[model samples]
Target: MAEVKSMFRDILSKQLPVEDITTMVLRKPKLLPLKSLTLEKLKKMHQAVQETTHQQEMVEKEQQQITH
Candidate 1:
């Protein structure tokens, strides 16, 4: 009985953790940016050019209508 009890205690002690404590720090998540800075700037420039061209075309159409 003594040998069995000791063996059981040993097994239990091995399986159980005593006074094990740890703190976890959760870091704030940042955006995983897909676009490069240069690419974003280029996209903006292209959009501006497209808008300017569209506006110019609308103005030309208006002038042509006024003349005709």
Candidate 2:
């Protein structure tokens, strides 16, 4: 419980859109073993998500430029 709440708070603090956070928590509950993860692990996961999102945005931008 406490760990789960802490992970939730950490995710919220990242300033992700509420819909995205909700989807992340609800859509893939099995993917995140929040109860078993350490604080360090949670931070790493957050960083990875951010990096992946950035990469996705860059890819979309490149695709748009190519099409234009």
Name the candidate that leads on lDDT.
1
Clashes of each: 0, 0
TM-score of each: 0.55, 0.45
User: Which residue pairs collide, candidate 1?
Assistant: none
Off by over 4 Å in 2: 1-37
Candidate RMSDs in order: 8.0, 25.9
lDDT of each: 0.91, 0.85
Error of 1 at 52 (Å): 0.5
Worst 10 residues of 1 by lDDT: 16-25
The per-residue C-alpha lDDT of model 1 at residue 47 equals 100
lDDT of 2 by residue, 2-67 (tens): 999999999878886678656633364457654655877888999999999999999999999999
lDDT of prediction 1: 0.91
